[model samples]
Target: MKKQRANDSGWRGSPEVWFQAAIEILLESGVDAVKISTLAKRLNISRTSFYWFFADREELLSALVDAWKDKNTGSIITQSEAYADSLAEATLNVFDCWLDDTLFDSRFEFAIRSWSLQSREIQSEVKQADAIRLESLSRMFSRFGFSDLQADVHARTIYLVQIGYISMQTKESLADRMIRIPDYVKTFTGEYPKQNELERFYYRHGYKNNASS
Candidate 1:
């Protein structure tokens, strides 16, 4: 039998490796930088190896968008639906996404929004995500006894404010943001979080000190 080189012996990188490398490039540069050759170079593998994982650059890009939908949009829907004893507590659940990167990837959201400017398909996706997210928030508010109009208005207020934060690239320390959570919950839900509610929220985020209004 002839000797086979490691590269020819199925040394292609895994799908996750290519997908993550693509995301890194997308985040670091922009959508334009996410190319098969670029990713292959970054992974230090044969260009052909990419084909084993993705059909083309477009497929990989689509996967990235899907990931954004799952992580960013999905997180809000999940958090909005989480069980809470009061509207204030429910609002805090949604706020967890803003504070925790694991629940929501703000950098990925920013990159996708930037990519939307170049692709009408992605722009439509972003718009649809906004609608879906807003609807979920509205439902969350309605569950707490808000009228339809009130729910819609409050939903927009919360969603738009968070989007504004991501779009503006606002930076605030965790402690500073923590101190404002109770007021934010009150402002959004028209009900201040109880002391116990605030304590639970702080505990969930591993904050040692309770936030004060």
Candidate 2:
């Protein structure tokens, strides 16, 4: 990951690289190591190259959180429509996405959670994002005929668990996470876990098997 430090000039690459680098360094090292210069160096670009996409550090942070929302919340909410077979399937799909999506990976969630300690803007964004996510869960539960207030309480609990679980470093497989998440969802709504293998939620995508990074 060693590279030349980017100076604010060219579009070295997509803003995604900077966001990804910021999360990686933030998790592996800490917020102190997530500066624009650090990201540029990580990407083998110039520090100033950051400005080609983001105006300042705060903007980069905001963009990171926003991208996180798109992956963890927006995509899940949209795909929730296709999850008509069962509520357990839908909820697990969202929870599994938390682990599988690069935007909500352990690196980024750990970073944003740490960065939120000082940045009120990021705190607000995080709160807003969580609320939206809970709402999506609530709506999904209601679609399965769960009561409104019950859905709200259950959704909040499930959402918190999903986020908390992200920070857990386990030797479990993506399939294990996919298999286990349904227990949390069932706990939240008092719904029963899938009794048959056919009804269990299974992830259909590949998690980047990042062995070296």
Candidate 3:
């Protein structure tokens, strides 16, 4: 825990402010680094101020897990349920999450997964999130007329690949990833996205001219 001035004379940070600071520490140095004293120094507030927003460290940690569930898992469920005219379009809608940080926080996801390795509770939460996300994806596929078994398999394929990317922290240039998007979509959905659909996806990601189609 790095030391800094605890300028908590009159300023008390809100829950969101405290949570964001904790998230920064968690992402930068893992969960163990997210201490009240450290956060106070980081936020320039008193260590006691943390209690104004949370009962204790465990409460704050619980909030972090809840936020992870709401953001990452919730994003997947939302995207899976988003309307699309075709399976390819539906798959692309889900893929939008990978390209858009506002929709999916990959670094946060990676950090939570890493934290799960040390805590059985977090590990269970991760497993539950995975099952829920997979079920949502399966439903997405089922909506396109796939049988339950086929939908489950395809959903797993799509999800496991993305999880592999996050777990491995795979890096690829935007152009490189863009070049592969169509094929990946095809592989996931068994249908290549049409040129117009690709354009829409690219535009949504602010890469309108990057569409291979």
Candidate 4:
């Protein structure tokens, strides 16, 4: 047998590379399909390389959970904390996750939620994440002058809507979603966003009006 190189695909058999491959497999074929041999074959590297990073399959699975926590939950909280002049802007910042994948991986969210069905540990983690997200959103609303009760309610509404979208695997074109954002902002915040705020958001996310289309 030919000796396989460690640095195939310029990845150097890094833990992140393994985690990324595992996540891809998890998304495509569920958690059970994320076996070590499958990943080594998929990456075109030796299975031994995996041992250097992870002790076993369980370790890789734990890394997956941590990655999802850090990437999806952590990113959204950071976005929520970003400076915004108004509640509308803060809401828009949260909305960016729905419009963008780099900040929030809806697929990952769905995968973990599915995984949670099979394991109590994952279920507890998901529950904690949900609470943290809800708290962050509620604080955003409170900062915008909503009463504590109102903020919590609004936060739950937004969180549930987003979760529903992910759970149902809803799909909408970027333009269609873009058109509805203003209405969503208005409904969520009880005020339409300012023109400049809307413009800045569009520019930041590269949304085009495409009037002719």
Candidate 5:
């Protein structure tokens, strides 16, 4: 945590630096708490420095929305685009988002959705993001030989389940989620994952086998 005053120090003053602080505040408190004064104090910088990066607080909020779009929605689309030998494999790629925060942060998602409650603008952005994400999941299913209707339904099922999980603030341990993952993949894709497919996913994520645990 590099905390320093603007006049007496070496703050990079990067937009991302400010954006990060704002996001932290947004998650911890509500969007209203993401004020320039609060962020300046959090970053240990002068309030004037914030204007250098954002014209206004709304600009900063928009930046947060863009960040959520890029990280959460973009990542899922990228995973959906990646090569998968089977439907289950493709489903697991999406599953990686749920398991890994770096890929799709549930906290950010929840925070943004919460913010949406107060602003139609944010709500519209969230809806658009949902459409993009669902489309990506639908395409992933289509590539795996599912018909259009089937792909659409499966995509909605996969996406809504995760959204519902976040909205409900469901709590489950990593080990518990890992134990349920294979069954989840199978149910979504309608085929049991082969051992190798399961192994690849588990090894990539460093999940210990439940049986061995």
Candidate 6:
């Protein structure tokens, strides 16, 4: 597999190769097998070559967290086009994409979450990612008529469910989660989701305009 290029369809030899290999190692053998030496062997490269891409294993892990964050959060914020007709649907598409085979890769998600438990740095990254996610989700809630407190509380539940699901690494299907998010959201807001402005906004852009405020 080659690194994707602006116009090319395959790998161009970059950190992603190692990152995916790391995920594979973690999934096939467990997080314990994702070390630099293991990754080198898995990738048929020298351990010293890892330094060319990352300073060390911790740095590589940091890069992995960044990749995960980009996959989960960054795309929604930067990609979805701002449009009137399908705005909400486009915004919330990130959650929907979580169901995709390439993106949803549950084993990798579970491994990342599991690794985060033992590494303070990883946990910190996860927390930061969650904070951004919650703020984004809260906006969608409020945009759909929920108040600040209500939106925040609802967002918290959603965050917990996602993390808890990863923690449990449930064998359930994405269809189940998609069906269940509405039920989960209804817990605090007392309203079910519809393909309205809010859902459109979330599908198009799942993000808080201002996290600092």
lDDT of each: 0.90, 0.66, 0.90, 0.87, 0.87, 0.60
Compared with the true structure, what per-residue lDDT tens digits does model 2 show for residues 1-213? 223347622457656677778767777887777798778877898787777677789777666677667766676576555555667666656654665555345556666777778888778877887777778878888898889998888777877766666656445676565445556666765665454422333424543323312
Residues 1-213, model 1: lDDT tens digits: 122345654568778788899999999999999998899899899998888767788888899999999998999999999999899988999998998889999999999999999999999999999999999999999998899999999999999999999999999987888888878887888889999888888888888783243
| Predicted structure 3: clash tally | 0
Looking at model 1, residue 80 earns an lDDT score of 97
Query: What's model 6's TM-score?
Result: 0.66
**Candidate 4 lDDT, 36-75, residue by residue in tens:** 9999999988888888777889988988998899988887
Per-residue CA lDDT of model 5 for 7-66, tens digit only, reads 633454767788888889988998989998898888888898777667888777878888
Superposed Cα deviation of residue 163, candidate 6 (Å): 2.3
Model 3 per-residue lDDT tens digits across residues 25-130: 9999999999999999999998887877688899989989999999899999999999999999999989988989888899999999999999999999999999
Off by over 4 Å in 5: 1-12, 210-213
> For residue 154, what is the lDDT in candidate 4?
95
Maximum-lDDT candidate: 3
TM-score of 3: 0.93
Candidate 1 residue 77 Cα shift, in angstroms, is 0.8
Identify the superior model by lDDT, candidate 1 or candidate 4.
1
How close is every model to the real structure, measured as TM-score?
0.93, 0.72, 0.93, 0.90, 0.92, 0.66
Model 1 lDDT on a 0 to 1 scale: 0.90
**Candidate that beats the other on TM-score, 2 or 4, i.e. the better one:** 4
Candidate 4, residue 65: the lDDT equals: 93
Write out the backbone clash pairs for model 5: none
| CA shift of 133, model 6, Å | 0.7
